[model samples]
Target: MGIKAFLSEPLARYIVAQQHEWIAASREVQEKWRTGLVQKAMNTQFGKDHFFKDIHSYVDFKSAVPVSDYEDLKGYISKIKEGEENILWPGKPLYFAKTSGTTSGTKYIPISKDSISNHINSARNAILTYIAETGKAQFLDNKLIFLSGSPVLTETGGVLTGRLSGISNHHVPAYLRANQLPSYETNCIEDWETKLDKIIDETIDQPMSLISGIPPWVQMYFDRIIARTGKKIKDVFPEFSLFIYGGVNFEPYRAKLFESIGKPIDSIELYPASEGFFAYQDSQDEEGLLLLLDTGIFYEFIPTENFFDENPKRLSIGEVEIGKNYAMIINNNAGLWGYSLGDTIRFVSTNPYRVLVTGRIKHFISAFGEHVIGEEIEKALRYGMERHPEVEVVEFTVAPMVAPEQGGLPYHEWLVEFATLPNNMEQFVQDVDRRLTELNVYYDDLIKGSILRQLVLKPLRKNSFIDYMRASGKLGGQNKVPRLSNDRKIADELTKINQ
Candidate 1:
């Protein structure tokens, strides 16, 4: 069946019809956008009106507005606390998705009712398409396990203010709804700790066919299941057909996960985020085709090389080139216009518009001033792994650390979990270092003498990432473990056990 036929007929028609409306709306917005009207309005509203007096004052005013980091929205957040209308949205937002902030404790991003509805529709469509591709729709009559965040409600006047996940849960299909175990919503437990226990208890004996969530949480659930039942995931759910995951890269956990489940590689990888359900792996071999939720948002790509340059160019959906890294900026109906999500991605093709996510823009190491990005690290790691047939990396993260103890130059410390601990751990580390040096000239210079001390390796258990996530209270649900920690403390804490 074609992509359209794969969707539920009524839903397909609704989405297509909505797409037409969006296209018209987008054209109107883009016209105004090109004229810098949106930026003018936003600046007047957001700033005290003194800044951005004229649109031409800021470069790229049409495609770019003055950047608003998480700190810039504090006043709006305070307004939310005071029960006043916030400037983040055009109208009263239906709900807020609490996301982590670097400096701010937590950021409550507004999601309008319309945006929530769009998210729901996009997610459902992704699932349907996935089922069609895998031919697993036939087997989905059995129960599905969703490892998601518990619905958190803001307490107001002795009552819950907004039950976020509960609203989404209500929209689940009637047939499949009953089969779903008690989520963070139905459980009265407010603490995530208690909610996780409840989720584990509910699924221990259930016949779950499909598992979905951020990878670390799913791994934690699998760990808990094994601990409780003394059986591997394959033993617990022999009929399992799907392992849907998103929110973080799954490459590091692949070997251990596949070994435990005894499932084919195709059983894993699904990409969905809080903003919207973006994409999913269409076929076993094909990298994810980003089915533009054209109805949800208008997409824009800013080339990675241009991000730091004074005069940068942006590409609309049609204009983007394949194999070039770009940062995603979206003008979504959710009230975020020209917002940079800090993720770097590359298009694989444009016909159906397939893309591969490279990594986070902010998550990179440059101890020796080489400006090594996550893409480079992934490439280097993969190359090293391919060369060494005996070793399989289970979990790995690289961090730049001061090396006073090891000769006083900054160094990249690798915390690696291998299938088998290498007899010559130093040799393995040196080999990886050599591979990385070959990839970048600066790395070679740093390694030889100037800036870097030495490549260090700390071996970990196969399930170390899973353990780390569980320990951090991020396991299960929406929260994901970051592959690279810019801060040294988190990275140090992660390496402690291995050391």
Candidate 2:
């Protein structure tokens, strides 16, 4: 390695220390962020036309700024609908990072040139930290296989509008950039089917030293790789060292991925989003550390229990409490001020801000890592128990079961009390398996030949989820059923009911 490359680890440590000092000393950053929020509230169309005369008069101006969902950005969509720059950033952004919103199927979030530079700097810091922790700077020479988003750009009036992965591919370090495989341009559309096939074909013969992507997509890619190559992943990419993943929890897919790759837990978790690149695994051995990008964005942490509570206190990096889960709020340069990234994490240490991700406060299934969401499991059960063509799902609750006799592994037992029972119960169970397999390849692998057997579909009375919700005292408002459960008592009770 060159002297510059060799010094990267020490430099990274120095930068991290400097950031901690900045957070400690800078009261101006916090004041400036709050001032920016006041300015946004004053200028906001919602606040001016509806709420109050001026931003200062608005009651709880921070709270008054309506929490925006995907639908809220529909006006801006028209500009990018024609692949043109519209709102939020100065000048045309480099490209959009295609992300799946809760309601919007696929939306392109802008990635400005400044944002790209921040991402690069954050990524480099993460690498350097890893090297510093492991004393493995020589490993940097190994090839990295990014199971990244496709590089294809949509042509609207001869203009390119797509994800930043492609744009970044053209801009990474020359030494590292030289090792990448060809892009999946032809299969780069939003359709998962086409993209999956292309990923499989491309990765089959390539020598991959490190891999990175979301866990579900990575599992799907490997499944296709195995199917197309007719060889196990170990037989192909035996040299694979690191598995870098983010966007979702890795626990659900962890066992299956290890089985397929026949690799150890040599993995790294990153906490990045379309909005910004935030934290990454500082050490190869430690869980993850939230290295505040002090120059890139201002940070805030709201305790998870205070998400919807009347008076929520926002904690800055310096004031954040350790061992308590907090939702991330960011003041990003791309015009997002005090924006919630919808991720929940807890501080592991305060000095360096090491943290562990504890799932999305809104995106958990009873705080467990089983890949089931409310809509997904409900639809699966309803479709599974189809006695008559009109058979529909009225309610359902997915409970976890650990059966030693049944392959000695934990499984999701669907207490699916349907509106109508299916004529053939076996067929219903099989249909549930098929649907789940189609949705998540990891679940499919477990059901097929791994430790777990098929998912148990138990018919319950209608209003199961509702009854459960009511019993939990989360009857109406915005409360929903827990999709996954880790509480042993709940899991055991549900498992007993299934049995």
Which candidate has the top score in TM-score? 1
What candidate 2 gets wrong by more than 4 Å, as runs, is: 1-67, 70-92, 104-108, 155-160, 184-205, 226-232, 309-312, 364-499
lDDT per residue (tens digit) for residues 1-499 in model 2: 7454476668767866765675565545555644554454343433353343444522354555443444565555446545554344444556666655555777666566656776777776666666666665544555566656556666532345655555555567766765655353633444455655665566667667677776655665776777777777778887677777876555434655776787674677777677788878876555556655454566777887688776677776667877787888775555455567777778887655678766565653332234544344544544554433434444344655665454666666766544456677787778877787776555666666665667776676544544554454433221234444444354444444445
lDDT of 1 by residue, 1-499 (tens): 4333344455545544554464455444444443443443353244233233444522444424533445655676456545555254444566666666666777666666657766676667666655544554533556677666555466432223443444466567765676677653545465555676778777767777777776655665666677778888877887677777766667655655676676673454555554555565555667755545354565667888787666467667667788888988765555565667778888887656777788887787775576667777767766666565556665678787765464666778777767656566677667777778887787787778666766677777666765676677654456554555555766777766555
Q: Which window of ten consecutive residues has the lowest lDDT sum in model 1?
A: 43-52
User: Cα lDDT of model 1 overall?
Assistant: 0.62
lDDT of 1 at 247: 66
Determine the C-alpha RMSD for candidate 1 after optimal superposition of all C-alphas: 4.9
Per-model TM values vs. the true structure: 0.81, 0.62
